[model samples]
Target: MRSDQPNYDVDPTILQPPGTPVWVADEAWRELARAAARLDRAVVVVDCYPGVDEQAVKASLERVFDVVVSVPDEAARPTEEIDALVAANLGDDRVFGYITQFNVADLYDEARLAELRRRVHERTGPIVLMGWGARLAAPDADVLVLADMPRWEHQLRMRAGMPNWRCKNGDEDILRKYKRSFFVEWRMADRHKQPLLDALDYLLDTTISADEARLITGDTFRSALDAAITRPFRFVPYFDPGVWGGHWMQEVLGLPGDVPNYAWGFDCVPEENSLALDIDGVRVEMPSQNLVLRKPIELMGPGTFARFGADFPIRFDFLDTFGGGNLSLQVHPLTGYIQEKFGMKYTQDESYYLLDVGDDGGVYLGRKPGADFDEMFDELEKAQRGEGSFPDERFINRFNARKHDHVLIPAGTVHCSTRNTMVLEISATSYIFTFKMWDWDRVGLDGKPRPVHLDHARANVQWDRDTDWVTSNLINRIDVLEQGDGYRIERTGLHELEYIETVRHWFSVPTLRDTQSTVHVLNLVEGRAAVVESPTGAFEPYEVHYAETFIVPAHVGEYTIRPADGAGECATLTAHVRGTEFPRSVSGEDLRFSGRSAS
Candidate 1:
């Protein structure tokens, strides 16, 4: 029999609605029908997230309204113009692109927009305007219905021969389509959507299927968003396989066996993760970021929202190479380099916390002290040119990893998590700015060579951070700040350069924690299950399992973490913005984040 003792949760949800307010199937259509009774010549706009099936919407609208106008057909920019607009961000390569500064409204024709506006006004019947950014077509529509879907759903649609918004390239490469979405379409769409989502009249969910749509009133949606920030919750985690993917997640996480392996488990990357709502027992899914967008002050705190502006500044994900191959050696750009090169606000500064590792293998990190740089770059370029494999051992330092060992990697530091290790990667939320210098001479799962940005790596690598620096500062620099009645707190190294501060707690009994005005993301790294509860019952008691990540809202103020009833010793790793002081290793009340943070 296949093994089935895995405890990974695949469908974690947040925000349980109070009543059965959702309308489904024909009831959804009837709700729209009642809204457009042709009594007063009303206009309803179904503004959509890109990749939504316009035809499905048109059919649904045609069933309810006498006049249905597709906003995309009315004002979408010409195909040639769209290609020219996104060309810079859609660089010649496949897996990379700079973030686009354009907006979805910029993809409209002003002349056509005016004409459509006139036509809608001239109509004497209940009219429906629909498409991506459809409200841009009729700004003062009587009722606003926002059709939204998760990014993962959009990726699935892309694989199903759907084109990028306003383009006719359905048969194009999937990677290119994703690149378009990542660097261009999504950025533009999100910018257009945030304000609209803030005041939407209705929130529509069509991710389950086109034929069966779920509809909820905007009031209920807002209630759900409000409820989300009062407690700790988990986002739906999505898993994917890659060239260096391994079977650990598939076996340990109880994933479907259809994929070859599970390489990445996006546990806390909300931008791509789904947040499920338990709406009267019928689970509905939406992008987790909507919570971040609609309730930043409550969820992320005022200081954090003011600093990052609705973006979830911290990220937690898994990189499993156990029973597989090495991850590509890479470097992240410095803040100035990323800002100047990619139009981004910040750079990725990360740490790899080893969850599991074998004795013979470790992580490749930093470089040998005083290595010949000219020769290393030349060799990498030659490897990119197919001359030979980049000789990693000649220049890079390999540090042996162990269970619960944390490795801090600042921007421009060369590093990679090698085979036979399960890594929980905690970092700043700039998720996709890695500059790959080498890939161990292998193609991707698509059987094509992975893109290596040797030039970018050369421009940013910190030559001074050699073996000595990494050993002294990055590897396993844990400071035991305090031991208390039933717990001890340890400050894990994330280096001074990184904005995220990580702390570990080992507890056999309940441990008290205060939010300290910053959001805390924690993982049950060494326990079967742990319980998170409010001191005064401010929130429901939340249960978390091993390798599971949950968020404590910045305003939670005070909470407690302990092993689920009768469970044994447990450990957790918590990450928050660096705002508290780090105290020297000591006894008594000097615990990192004990009463304060473990600084």
Candidate 2:
């Protein structure tokens, strides 16, 4: 079709002589078989054009189907007569319909189309249409139009400008065609929705007004807030300013102001991490206000930890700034190593829930197979001594992260969250974790090179040959279940103190049953559930409209849950001590641990 070439019809082989065309005999029979087979399904053959013999065609289709109907070619036939012919074919096993091959181009009438639809519904089987008739068939009629009559891939082939092989251009053409044809396959995303909401939310929230934070994490926060549809919540770690080197964005995460900045290199809130979630209509607040510790003696002032009690530890702040940059690739040590190495004073297990990512955005985790530790250490030694740079080529495995994806890290897994995106991090208690490696060789603002802990990192890195340190734990997954008022408690992991779970109901449901005492943390993951206590007045149910975590004491009373605030069906997560029974909330004491030592 292009101007460079003269037009020449590509003739099909039907006109070739029987013997001269080597492939004609086989092709003719195949066509005869197919055309004849399609005709056999109807009770009467309806041919708007009159070239073919009805009896012979009907005879040929006898083996495959019962009947065939063909329309009279002469225009002398009335619509009623044709209609009667169609009705006559309507039997228990046979019915009449139309095909696009009829070639009735100008026969499109709304009245006739409506009548056809009524007849189709009255008939038991489908109404078939072909070619031009297919274009006029009633919507209710089942239409089976041939897709390849004009060669469906004609446009694609023309776009490629080549016929021999599919090049990138050809592949793209094919992909574009596929995307256009399929529902989920080819649809373009509505990109502005999240961005617009994020901008508006930033404009309204005068407080927490760090422009860097507003720019980087606004989409993530807004998208999360805008999700009115009830579904499982996923957390990703895209906002860590620790990634992309020590950018100004990282500093903004800790502080509250500054804009047009990059990563906020330092954290301001050193004691506790916080998340502001608007669950349903409820505003549930959990602040990191209790992480201060009273050491043997305070150094400069009261330490952040000394002032806070047995509340939550491990704080992380929001940072937003530079899109892409360099950062260390690392993971944390497992629980055993932390207890052994840090004298049982640290706990850190985390995961990344990426909210946004770039085309080249990636995270590097673990080392590749056959990676020589000696060689890696040699590079590390040079980098640490300010001699050379860390080896960037060999050890890392990159993964293309995306929005609403959760990647769980159990610990001792060498990993780094990298480049261009916002992410939410969710993980277990205890914040102390070791960084395994760094890539860039730049000095910080302090005029000293950044600290590198190669020995500690190498000691905790998982080196198993079969393990895929990068993608092993990163996936979008959730478990949803239903149970009665007195719930089903099951153990999901091995540790004796794996976790504690407890459920208490504030309202009495007659179905509530008595259960044993077990130490556990109770979280209203979904609908509101009530707990009944003998001492305290009827307390409101733990409302979990958003991402809220709450602790349930070991011993609680007869707790019953009824639907709260007109909300039906509640979902809750209870993590409990191993091999223990559910505790009664009324007593506030666990007889099982009445005499146990604090340690």
Candidate 3:
């Protein structure tokens, strides 16, 4: 409803016209204005996370409406009973307005929902059904609004004792408790709401003040999505402290010095990372998966989208061990193993691109020459039971690591990044399937031994990948493909893996290229920064800094890259799905070593 005093601090361009019914999915802190001039009857139904301020919302609604009714005075009644009670109150002369709690658990009852909507449709005045599931329940709503906050911000609020519907005990582990109880529900709600975005009238960034809930219209939302896909975007990086965490991120990434140590930085992981959007000098964050969900074919090429659907098939992250300890010796399940056991479509075929390394930096990769698999298994079992110690040096081979060295790690390979090194991990989207085999007989940061997965490791380990074979086949195999004035292109990756391909471009002058309907994930490995611009001046130029990762959307077709104004020559690693072409340097002999026939 209209308000002469400016009911909301929203961008005027994105606000709905007067008399539009809006369904707002919002944070507890923000509420619809109580005293709008146009609303003769207004209702606010709130079934929110445990810690929201329900009383404030009720108070706000009462200030404007002629009458306000809170249905089902008993909060624990069944949905059918609650609906009957609400229906019974509709004829009350004073019940011109209704504020009812719409619970997530009630979404399963389609028949009950249809009946409830039919009853509401018979009413005569304006109605505002505002809550978590209100939009889903009322599909014919005039406007849909999503009120969101970044996960980290929500965690901070939860830690500060924000009213939560799930957590009542006020435990010290409230964040963990809240996530355990409601994360799945939140994810489901997010997925269900994404398809309705085209009908969204306004997206309120509730992280801001109520007066400034950044309003984004449906058209603006579409524009932002297009810009997000075509431009160099950054996901909000999340950091974690682990027992084996190191100081590199704290020093290099200049993270807050308060954390004990930084172990991993999720840079572009859509499953866990949130995209930060700067809109009109205000910041708004949403799950990164929303981009892929909104424009699959535009973000990922048509071919890739056809193959993977809405999945963003690649992941990039940082593993910081500089001035710390080694990672546990681990193996990832093979493609078939993961599909059968984990119900996943793909396996984790990863690589380690060393960003920085100390003098003793090295990677524990493959098995030692002449390693006895049966003996190793016996030793592993004994170590697990505290009956014997692991002979680390005698069973695994260690390869010295240098800055910018690329180490390929196909599924089933045993590997770990050693201490005093920072690794830029590039891999398939399937993560969290690691099988730790050894941990140097050391305990975790909690002073307890970490659980090991020896059986799983043994089941997937490739016994044929010994020191000699790994050194000859998995090590850096770079071959110059083409050279020009002040520029060169080289093929560099685990080409025999048959999943994804990587190439490097070293150039000082401007270069133009097309994506060819294939998405490319790139990192400027060896320059201060570079400017990526539309070849036809269609969009703004995107400036990417050194060590920064960005994506080239499949639909962009062609783009140009040049050294940032004052920077020198630049080297960028470009990664994409390997459709059909095979590297020319990988001989049939190398393919045999990898146990794969040449294509």
Using all chains and alpha carbons, the TM-scores for the candidates as numbered come to 0.95, 0.38, 0.77
Q: After superposition, how far is residue 176 of candidate 3 from its true place, in Å?
A: 8.7
- Cα lDDT tens digits, model 2, 1-599, are 01112111111011111222111223322332344346423222122111112233333334333322221211123545433433322222111111111113223455565564455446543223322232233332221211110112222233344221111233333323332222110011111111222222111111111121111122333333333111111121122223343232332223233433345321212222222334232222111121111111111111212322333333232222136464466667666766664433444665554434555655555567777767877877787777877775676565666643445555666666666644434444444354547747665443445456677677876676223534443343332222334343232222222222222222223223222433233333334333322223333333233112333322332333334455454443333333445344425554322211111
Name the candidate, 1 or 2, with the larger TM-score value.
Answer: 1
TM-score quality measure for candidate 3: 0.77
Candidate 1 residue-pair clash tally? 7
Q: How well is each residue in 412-507 modelled by candidate 1, as lDDT tens digits?
A: 999999888899999999878999999999998878788888888999999999999999999999999887767788999689998888989999
In candidate 1 the C-alpha lDDT for residue 447 amounts to: 83
Best by lDDT: 1
Cα-based RMSD of the predictions, in order?
3.2, 29.4, 11.6
Clashes of each: 7, 81, 7
The per-model lDDT (C-alpha) reads: 0.85, 0.34, 0.64
Query: How does candidate 2 fare on TM-score?
Result: 0.38
Model number with the top TM-score? 1
Residue 6's lDDT in candidate 3 = 17
